[model samples]
Target: MTDETLHLRRLRSPIGRIEVVGDGRAVTSLAIERDGMLPHDGEDESGDPVLDRAVAQLEEYFAGTRHDFDVPVDLHGTAFQRAVWEQIVQLQWGEVVSYGDLGQATGRATAGRAVGGAVGANPVPIIVPCHRVLGADGRITGYSGGEGIPTKSWLLEHEGVPHTVPASARPRATDVTAAELDLPADAPAA
Candidate 1:
């Protein structure tokens, strides 16, 4: 059971600090920094039931142990944004889709820029898998969520996809988790 207040919490990942917001029943928003100020300080990981579940899932994801997220989501977006987000969720782990392609998937084949706008505003990045979306030529463009495009590439690499990082940058394993890695439980056999 939860009090009536909206929930928020800070979770430290190998990448950086993550701020999560929820309404007790479902996660509403997740950001890298302490996402905007709320009325009440949300309980820590172990104290809030909703937060505890979210943190656990995120930790498992960073460890490359879980692929899909099963938690309920409470996204507040316009109808078009909701449609785009729904398409994003359909993307399987390790799969990447171009912005134009996403527009097509949402039956808005000519709304590529509009699609990009929605992708940028995606309140939840990882679990909804917004990083899985890309620009033309399958190259990464702007990704302001979490730790930025590096985290996106890292996520792709973790998913066993050959993703290109910025410049000569390569994501070190330590950027993901501190614990010894578990042999990627479900990385697709190449």
Candidate 2:
């Protein structure tokens, strides 16, 4: 990382708390809290214009009053990752694209997995809109932000993007029991 000192600001959202990091001029990272913990280290500087603006825009986004972000960002990543993030940033508020489609957009039609890696490596999420990307079958394969799939699900639901949660990841019915299902008491648990 650069020797430049980073500034930080945190905001509360429906999904969880979000932390924004900046280097005076542009936003450098936006991290969503995972399990009530933020995974970034930065000085808690107040009145920082960049961080302030980013927080404002993010608040507007969560409030549903803003559909796009104009706050400047300083993304640090490999060339391929940059290319993927660039394309992702162009997606409209409700638009969705598959990893394969994103890979093809970056002129690497067969690099869906690689594209996923780049997408995961994105430092700024909502601003860069990496949550807009999905699996080839419009399913949420995974998410590297906040509480993982649940966090991504919240964002997708907010944007009204149609996506499917894998059966394994879907919440199981907790109120049902052997008696409710009229099954034998000795039957194997579901």
On lDDT, the leading prediction is 2
Worst 10-residue lDDT window for candidate 1 reads: 173-182
Model 2 lDDT tens row, 1-190: 5544757888766667789988889998989877658866354544489889888887768766678999899998999999999999999999999999898999999997899899999999999999999987888988898878877877887788888987666422224344543344564432
**What C-alpha lDDT does candidate 2 achieve relative to the native structure?**
0.81
Q: For candidate 1, lDDT tens digit of each residue in 76-153? A: 899999999999988888888899988998899999889999999998888899989887776778686754676677
Model 2: lDDT of residue 128: 94
Residue 161, model 1, lDDT: 71
TM accuracy, model 1: 0.79
TM-scores across all candidates?
0.79, 0.84
**Candidate 1 lDDT score relative to the true structure:** 0.73
Model 1: CA > 4 A from native: 1-4, 34-47, 166-190
